[model samples]
Target: MLEKVAWMNMLFDFYGVLLTERQKDFMDLYYCQNLSLGEIAGEFNVTRQAVYDTLKRAEQVLSQYEEKLGLVTKSTAERNKLATAAAMLEEYETVKSDGRVQQARKIIEEVLEM
Candidate 1:
């Protein structure tokens, strides 16, 4: 559940920048907080299906934004780069060579660029 919350937060943070306030609020309550459709409908004074439709539309919008912008892809790339850098750093710590240290530093810089 915590992992789901983290993923939803990342998605919302990336795409919510492109959404209206109401859309952001609806998504936060429905996805991040895991509110029921009926509960969200009651809060918004709408029918359950209306709430579901709003969520579906919001998801479509988020998918479109990710498809166009590649934010999530870029984020994943950067995370992988950082993980590689961390592994290099751990190896360097054990080996302790000037050349290996320099290579690890280069990897860290490349990860930072990503």
Candidate 2:
């Protein structure tokens, strides 16, 4: 469940602008704010079923956007590559103490921060 929430958050971060304002609001409430369906429905003046359906639709839309664009996947892959490069640089630095390796590692860390 935690992983699914994290995945949804990642998808939302990548494709949330494509969603309607209501969709974004519900998503933020349910996922980021950790609100229950009943709670969200109460806040929105709607039924729990209505909130469920809207959330399901939003999830589907986000998943479809990811399927088409793969931005999240690409980003995860790039981060993984950067992490591997940083690790390799660290290992090399341990062996040689090269300032150039340290510089490259710092650059990779900056990119990962993005």
Candidate 3:
């Protein structure tokens, strides 16, 4: 579950970067396919330690880019806004009134714009 969360964050945070082919392949195998380091290494004909190091380096590069440009931070803030809007929608649903639902939908649209 933690790994899933990390991969989701990575996809959200670094999807715009121009990664090398090897880095893209490694990330896809590790995060999209949920492969273990050993499994990824075997697929690439590399040692497990090498695969681990590559992943670590890739993560560091992504982190550096995010820190410098704040893309990840903005994405996280947007995600939080959407989550809050969803909760508001749920609350409005329990009220069972068209006016309240419309107001909540408007709020959701504003949140989405953020």
Best by lDDT: 2
Q: Model 1 Cα displacement at 86 (Å)?
A: 1.0
Full-model lDDT for every candidate: 0.79, 0.96, 0.73
Q: Comparing 1 and 2 by TM-score, which wins?
A: 2
With a 3 Å backbone cut-off (N, CA, C), the pairs that clash in candidate 2 are none
Instruction: Kindly report the root-mean-square deviation of model 3 from the true structure over all alpha carbons.
Output: 3.9
Candidate 3: global Cα-lDDT?
0.73
Over 4 Å off, model 1: 1-8, 97-114
Least accurate 10 contiguous residues by lDDT in model 1: 105-114
Clashing pairs in 1: none
TM-score of 2: 0.98
Clashes of each: 0, 0, 0
Which ranges in model 2 have alpha carbons more than 4 Å from their true place?
Answer: none
Q: Candidate 3's residue-wise lDDT over 27-93, tens digit each?
A: 7787777899999999889999988888777766766776788766687788887778777877777
TM-score of 3: 0.68
lDDT of 2 by residue, 1-114 (tens): 999999999999999999999999999999999999999999999999999999999999999999999999999999999999999999999999889999999999999998
